[model samples]
Target: MAKVHAEAQKEQILNAAARLFIEKGFGGASMQEIAEALGMTRTAVYYYFKNKDEILTALVEEVTLRARRLSSRATSEANTDPKEWLRTLVHQHTMLILSHHNEFRVVDRTEQQLPERAYRANEEAKRAVLSNFTAAIEAGVKVGVFRVVDAKVTAFTMIGMCSWPAFWYKPDGPKSAEEIADTIAELAVQSVIRPARRQLKSAGDVSEALALLREDLDHLSLMIEKQPKSG
Candidate 1:
């Protein structure tokens, strides 16, 4: 019980530090600030972490381990559909970003600030995650579900698309993280899937489609103009 409590305290400290690191860059956030945010004495904070870098290292290590585990699980499913694998990857990645927003933001923005050894370790874990995506894409291509393309490039693109939400996602926003994840997962699969050839539309049909698209664009513009801007 004591060990569990200690682990919980350490997690609390890391969460506080992650929030400060997100609000203020790594260089700008101090141990004093983290301690104050958690309502603990600086010495108490030191009990769990020797310094800011140590705290950052812990956060990175935790994220890396989790990513590796998720990647392993994603790839281990026997004969899973490639589209299902992609959906799982995107959903898990999005949920991770949403649940650990501050930690992920800190890692994304302050990666260069980590010690060289720690940075390299994190990169290895990241590569493992990327490899899982690449494997899934290649499998899809082999099964004729996806179009022929560079699997590595497509994996990177899908990762970038999924990771972008960590920067803009809000828990209280109009769309829940699950909804956003669903949309991204659909788009990611669509991006790689082989499209069925269809007969070309006549000029009149194309013109009508374009007019409908214009109306939708106009409606979207008006909606955006009505929304209040943040500072």
Candidate 2:
């Protein structure tokens, strides 16, 4: 369809702009340069985006929107399973960074240069992602699955870990994005998971537990018998 084709063209422009923004700082990159990069005329770029600021804002919004949507979907799908929720969130986040490293890096590097609207949208998206992560961690802690820790702090830490890949990930690296994501996801899950301890077996465990209960009851009875009688 024509609409689909137009949307795809818009995405190409955004991708070209992201690369230019990374190579040249947001303030350094110009509309002409972005147009040239895409092999289009300056007027063509302008038709899609009025100015460099508009392009930058579009880039920021696209990346943030992607992350926010991923977080929402992961949270909803794993609503009943906090451990799975956290794992899914971390994995998806990691993949997002690696798959779109240029866009991620551009936004990360141009925070101060972001337009007012873009900045607000970025901050709101961040808060939404953090809220999902914190809530999931809190849920796990409540159910005694995750260790006791500051859920907000843990969420922030994991987010930082995932975001760092945007700076250093290489497409030709030994590990693919999915492999790296899997490793990090597992690490995040294990970090909060409750430590394992020896479990009581069905036979001896039940007998030992009952014996301890009986001892406590007998001690309570003795203490009550020793109490002075009321008139």
Candidate 3:
């Protein structure tokens, strides 16, 4: 497992660099500081990453690669149903941000400092992700599954909403990442789903009524599960 060990060590270096980049801007953080953070010599750090720029590039590449994979998986899972597709996208995106908040924050804070290659790759990945959201919203509108709204605007808003948690999510918080993801997914779906579709009492047919009731129950169950218990 030499390769596995090597990969793990590389990840350790990336993680340390991300933390330093978040605390100090990319320019402010140096290779020596990163090495010190990881209890490694400057030479050891160079073995993994040639320099601070290379480390930042690695971090950006890792984040973009994961985003691309996430979009592919979400699209494959709900190709036909725009509502399901959007929900899946939101959940996955939120989970990704929560899991890699430091990396995400560093990238955001140092956008101008990113290497040309890394910046280009990141923008491409972001455009693809946005396309997924926009296409899903448009499909939902076409099928009358969602209300009439600007798909691009909604996509941008939802994306911003999902990314906001990266600034404040806490690993030791009361809610787990999965729980927060579910909550955000539900909110995103609700925002686009037609008003009649959301209200159980207003459902026009028995099947529609049942579906709405089920969704409501699922959301209610999640809320109850998240409640703080009395001593």
Candidate 4:
């Protein structure tokens, strides 16, 4: 019963903190406000988290863990095609952002708000995601499928393309999350792997080629999941 109550209180505080932070910015929001929001005293809030920085740290840890989980599940599946695996990666990455939209907002905006260790941990997760992207690009390049570009930068850009929607995406508005994700995936394919160089003449060829790329992406996700667990 104690553990359950604590868990419920933790969620209450996190939800309250997310709302306050979004409304008042990280530094502007205080432990007092958070505690009041939860109908508790400041000491109660401090019992679960010592300071505002702890809340910020918790937010990053939560989403990075979700992203890591997505990669783990996709990678563990038995598949060898790089294109298909990459598509899965794209979808998984998009899903993570969409499913945890509130946490995503907190993470996207408040990461710099964390202390050095927390910030480094957040960057480490990001690096793992990008490293997966770089590996996918390299695998495709070796297969004569994805062209040789600056894999590191391109990988980072690809992630930005997919991740930006979480910032301004609205569920009942212009486009659905899945629609944007598919479009981003398509654009990423074109940007990272040029069709002109493939020596393939038709759109069908592009589709077929990417289908084969999925395996490499899946492998990349698996590698990231195996990292020192964060969050």
TM-score: which candidate is best? 3
Give the clashing residue pairs of candidate 2, or none.
none
- Arranged by TM-score with the best first, the candidates are 3, 2, 1, 4
Report the C-alpha lDDT of model 3 over 113-198, residue by residue, as the tens digit: 88898889888888988888888899888888898899999999999878889889999999999999999999999998987554
Clashing pairs in 1: none
The TM-score, computed over Cα atoms with residue i paired to residue i, of candidate 3 is 0.83
lDDT of 4 by residue, 47-78 (tens): 99988888878878777766766665665562
TM-score of structure candidate 4: 0.69
lDDT of 2 by residue, 93-117 (tens): 9998888889888887887888998
Q: Which stretches of candidate 1 lie over 4 Å from their true place?
A: 196-231
The 0-to-1 C-alpha lDDT of every candidate, in the order given, reads 0.84, 0.86, 0.86, 0.76
Candidate 1 Cα lDDT to native: 0.84
* lDDT (tens digit, per residue) of candidate 1 on 10-62: 98998888888877888888999988998999999999999988998899876
| TM-score list, all predictions | 0.79, 0.81, 0.83, 0.69
Clashes of each: 0, 0, 0, 14
